[model samples]
Target: MSRVLVVEDESAIAELISINLRHAGYEVTIAATSDQAQFEVDRVLPDLVVLDWMLPGQSGLALAKRWRSTARTRELPVIMLTARAEEADKIAGLDAGADDYLVKPFSTNELLARIRAVLRRKAPEALDALVDVGGLKLDPATRRVTRDDREVRIGPTEFRLLHFFMTHPERVHSRAQLLDRVWGDHVFIEERTVDVHVKRLREALEPVNCARMIETVRGAGYRLTQQVQALSN
Candidate 1:
């Protein structure tokens, strides 16, 4: 089940959101202050955060900005829930790294829909089905990557990158897209980070002679070709 953190200073609002989310089959946690919210995130990162714009101490905008600036929480998905419906306020919330924004007096159904949409976009690889392409196999459940039954040693980031490529084989994915999909959010992460992780993924696949499977498309991005034999040479 996807975990959701609801950060609202008002007890009634927080309880309402929490109850609705729980009823919808989501694991819900509520925080009545920015400090408590930060603590919850530090202890365990939730799949998504429903943050209130105004808080007791720090505003939701400030918290979102802080999370975006930190490497560990940079890719965290956030949806701003606030009474500030002005265009400028909405722009500021988005610029602060909110994936989606909802004003007060919002419908529960609409909020749920937005949460589902953001989670779908942010956690496309939430499924654990095995993916195989170009003789490379990745088992999300086991968290393993292999070629010809030989294990491929890789870091966490590289593993995720390879999983995405293998799942969408032969499709060229731009650096920005990769960052958004693999990193969960692209607003805070640099595009160059994709290059770094791609290099590492290739290095991990080198011993198995599958490094060339990931092709760098000129003037484009990268593609994991299904024609494994052709690239083996």
Candidate 2:
């Protein structure tokens, strides 16, 4: 069963959501405060988080930002729930890395639907399967990237980005597609951020000389091709 964490200060609403989620075949946990929510996440990372905007202490926006910056929780799928009902608030949540947003007074059916949609979108690339490309091997089981027995020191996000590229190599992926598939479908991060990470990923692969495998398709996006271009000494 998929695990879901619901963070909301309202007891009645929390219970209602938990009941609905449980009935829909989800294992549910509830946190009444931002601190408690963080504690719950630290204890057990859920498959998805349902976060309410108005928390007692830190607030859901802060919590979302914290989660996004943490390597362990960077890719945790989140659907933000809010009473603000403003487009700007929704944008803020997405900018903080929420995978989706729902305004207050939402139907349980809609909530459940959003949860299912986010999970479906994130499931495939979230696997722990190993990926290999262009003589560079990445083992998710070990969380290691190596070539010719030499290890590549990679940050978690870069590792994920590289894994996505390797899994779908030889094809150009537009920045929007990369963000959806690699960074979660609903982030409001700029496309330029993708360029930065791609540059960093190349830098990380430099020692192995595997950097050239990632090609910048001008006016398009990027492609991880099996064909390698010559590298400068």
TM-score of each: 0.57, 0.58
Looking at candidate 2, what is the lDDT of residue 15?
Answer: 98
Highest-lDDT candidate: 2
Q: lDDT for model 1, on a 0 to 1 scale? A: 0.87
Colliding pairs, model 1: none
Candidate 2 achieves a global lDDT of 0.87
- Tell me the tens digit of each residue's lDDT in model 2 across 1-233: 67899999999999999999999999899999999999988766778999999999899999999999985577789999999877888899999999999998999999998999999898777477666665688998899999889999999989889988876556578898888888996577888989999999999999988888988999999988766634422
Model 2, residue 166: distance off in Å is 17
Please state every model's RMSD to the true fold in angstroms.
15.2, 15.3
Model 2 residue runs over 4 Å out of place are 128-233
Clashes per model (N, Cα, C within 3 A):
0, 0
